[model samples]
Target: MSTKASRAAARLMISPSVILLLGWMLIPLGMTLYFSVLRFNLLMPGDNPFVGFENYRYFLTDPGFTAAIWNTLALVLGVLVITIFGGILLALLLDQPMFGQGIVRILVIAPFFVMPTVSALVWKNMFLNPVNGLFAHLFTALGLQPYDFLSQAPLASIIGIVAWQWLPFATLILLTALQSLDSEQLEAAEMDGATPLSRFWYIMLPHLARAITVVILIQTIFLLSVFAEILVTTNGGPGYASTNLTYLIYVQSLLQYDVGMGSAGGVVAIILANIVAIFLMRMIGKNLEA
Candidate 1:
């Protein structure tokens, strides 16, 4: 077929999927946008009147909103720091020719496949529980009092749980990147009297920079919306201590039955998420160019 004819045929074949995808995305977004302006509450449903920016104002001015924003940022940053650093260390170890390498790698990445809710539940009841948890047992055996993780440090506990789930993903990515590193350069560095730390600092770490950025970008996107772990563990409780934007929206909409406020929060979250994504994308672009 001629080039123009082929191009036309390709467009014809892909048009349906493109239209469907657009509709799928745009429809809910349109509804959310529509609802965000109305004072629609489950308690008072009759004659929903339009209230332009009122919902946004209320949602933004909410006392929990600031705390939620801080918690969301802390959660994302804490998880990213842990996952990236831990992943790098784990990746280095996994890259070594160790016994049962394949099985070990599988075990390392196994946590990623586990459901977030399941992991949170395990962490909450089996490990962090102050009464009968493994940690409690260990503490008692060691003649120490068991620490209440979720209750005493809700945000930190959530961060640790989320970090555990994402660590494997970062490890897998960093390991793949590590595998592609030029070993000859490392050998040359060793021959040149380079120390292990020096080699890592000057060669390995630099080589893994792109993969690290990818991990951060991808993980940050999902980390912003981390809800399952929080819900299963803290329920955004201890007074919004672990309440990220997603959980805040859930409370506004489902718990409080304030659809308008929830929709407004959702919109704000989308804006903040896009802002972060765009910034990361630009950074990735710069890294790629480098």
Candidate 2:
């Protein structure tokens, strides 16, 4: 068979999967777009009239909308900052020859495998609880007051929880990148009496730029949709203090039963996410080219 015939045969084999994937994604999106332009509410069963942009107007004007957007951006940036810095420090430490190195790396990477809901629940009841929790116990031992993390500082607490979960992923990626670095370059720099900080700043960090960019791009996508952790912990509580965009959409759709408004919010979120993704893609493309 000619190369063209072989290519055609391969395309035919994969066409079913391509169609299935497209239908799976496009069908729900189409329905969401359809519902977003209507006055649909689960509470009101009858007279689901098309209201055009009314749903979008109401959703955008809602008070919670602004807070949710800010909270979403804060949560994403907070987690990214913590994970990148902490991951680099942990990666450098782990890359050094030490006793029980394998065990240490495994333990460090273990949290990334945990379910978000489970981790949030554990942190809520075990660590961040104001009473009878580990932090409370530690505080009492130190003659200080236990901090009411979820109640007083819900957003920050959520950021900490998310950062902890994602740190392992960043560390793993950075560690892989670090492991692939040329050892001779580092040895030569050290032989020339380059300080440790100088070596890291000049040699190591530049090598990990592409991996860091990759971690940011991938993590930002998932971080924008963070819901299970907030739902399990704060439920976007403390008066919308911890309500990220995803949780706000959930409240409108499921809790409030405002399906049209929720659908409109979903569309807005998709647009914002696409914008961020495009920006990150361009950044990564430039980094790759460099």
Candidate 3:
């Protein structure tokens, strides 16, 4: 076959999947951009005016937007810290040769398979409930007032739930990376009188840097759009305490019936996602180059 014909055949084979993926991605985005330029309210289905950047201005100036941004940042950072540290510790522990290690590893990974809604519901009612929850029971036994977790510590509650779900993922990634480290390198470090801390810091951490970056990049993408846990637990309440950009956009589009503002928020979210993606690509590219 000629080179041109081979290329044509390859393109024909890939065209269906490429077109499908492109349609899935672009349809919603195109709709968002379209709605963003028009003053369309779901409740009032009538002649909508073309508003240009007015919706953007409204979304930007809204106080809720700032709060959502702050909450989103805090949630992402908090989850990252917990998952990274806890994952490393758990990975180290699991790497040991011990009895029933396989069972323990399965147990460790089980939480990641739990649905977000189920996890959130279990946490809110069975654990964090002020009235009939485990914490309430403990407080009652100790003669203390039951704490309202979702009401008072909504962000922390959401973070805890999200971290619990993500911990296994981070651990698995880091553990895989750990298992790939050169045993000879570790032996040499020990021979050089390197302490455990020094070996971990200089040898292990440096070796795992790429894996860590991958985990961070992937986690950040999911963490930025965390929604189901927050929806089930707090519903972005206690006056927008746990509201992130995703929830804020949800409220704008669904609850408020303001399509224009919601689309503007969607645009902002896309920009933020792209910024994070660019940074992650740069970081990974630099690591690959090194």
Candidate 4:
């Protein structure tokens, strides 16, 4: 077939799936937008009257909304800081030759595969339980207090758990990038008496710059919407200590049975999420260009 004919045939083969995906996404969005302007509540089923931007006004004026925003930013920043620094150290360590290297790498990358709910449950029960958890036992043995992670430090604990889960992915990406670095340059630097710190700062870190930025951009997208961990662990308890925007939206939509308000929150979340995504995409594009 001619090139134009083949192009047309390729488009024909892909159009259905593309159209289906668009419909799937746009239909729910349209419904959400429609509902967001109404006064609908599942609990008080009556006339679902049109109330333009009233839902948005209520949702935005909510006291929890502000806290949720801060918590979301803190959570994302905490995870990014931990994962970027920790992943870099791990990548550097794993890059070195050692016995059982393959096994170590496997173990390092294993946490990324565990489901978020499962990992959060494990952290809550096995590690962070104040009574019979591993940390409690260790604290008791050391003659110290058994700290309650979920209660006392809900947001930080979630950050730690999330960072642990994402570290493997960051490590894998950075390791791949590190592996591509030219060895001869390092050898020359070493012969010229470059210290380890100097070698890492001057040679290695610059090489991993693009990979680090990529990891940050990708991880931020998912981290902002983190819910399962907060739900499973703290339930955003202690009065919104761990409640991010995602959890707040869930509470409004399901728990409160206020579909209109929930839809408003959803619309706000979509706007904020899109803004962040667009900013990150621009950064990624600039990095790629560089």
For all candidates in order, the CA lDDT equals 0.94, 0.96, 0.94, 0.95
Model 4, which residues run further than 4 Å from truth?
Answer: 283-290
* lDDT tens readout by residue for model 2, 1-290: 56998999999999999999999999999999999999999999988899999999998988899999999999999999999999999999999999999999999999999999899999999999999789999999999999999999999999999999999999999999999999999999999999999999999999999899889989999999999999989989989999999999999999999999999999999998998799788987886898
Question: Over the full model, what C-alpha lDDT does candidate 3 score relative to the true structure?
Answer: 0.94
Candidate 4, overall lDDT? Answer: 0.95
lDDT: the better of candidates 2 and 3: 2
Clashes of each: 0, 0, 0, 0
- Model 3 stretches with alpha carbons more than 4 Å out: 1-3, 282-290
TM-score of each: 0.95, 0.95, 0.94, 0.95
The count of residue-pair clashes in candidate 4 stands at 0
Instruction: Kindly list the per-residue Cα lDDT of model 3 for residues 1-290, writing each as its tens digit.
Output: 56998999999999999999999999999999999999999899988899899999999999999999999999999999999999999998998899999999999999999999999999999999999999999999999999998998999989999999999999999999999999999999899999999999999899888888888889999999999998888889888899999999999999999999999999999999998899788887887888
Angstrom error at residue 28, model 2 = 1.0
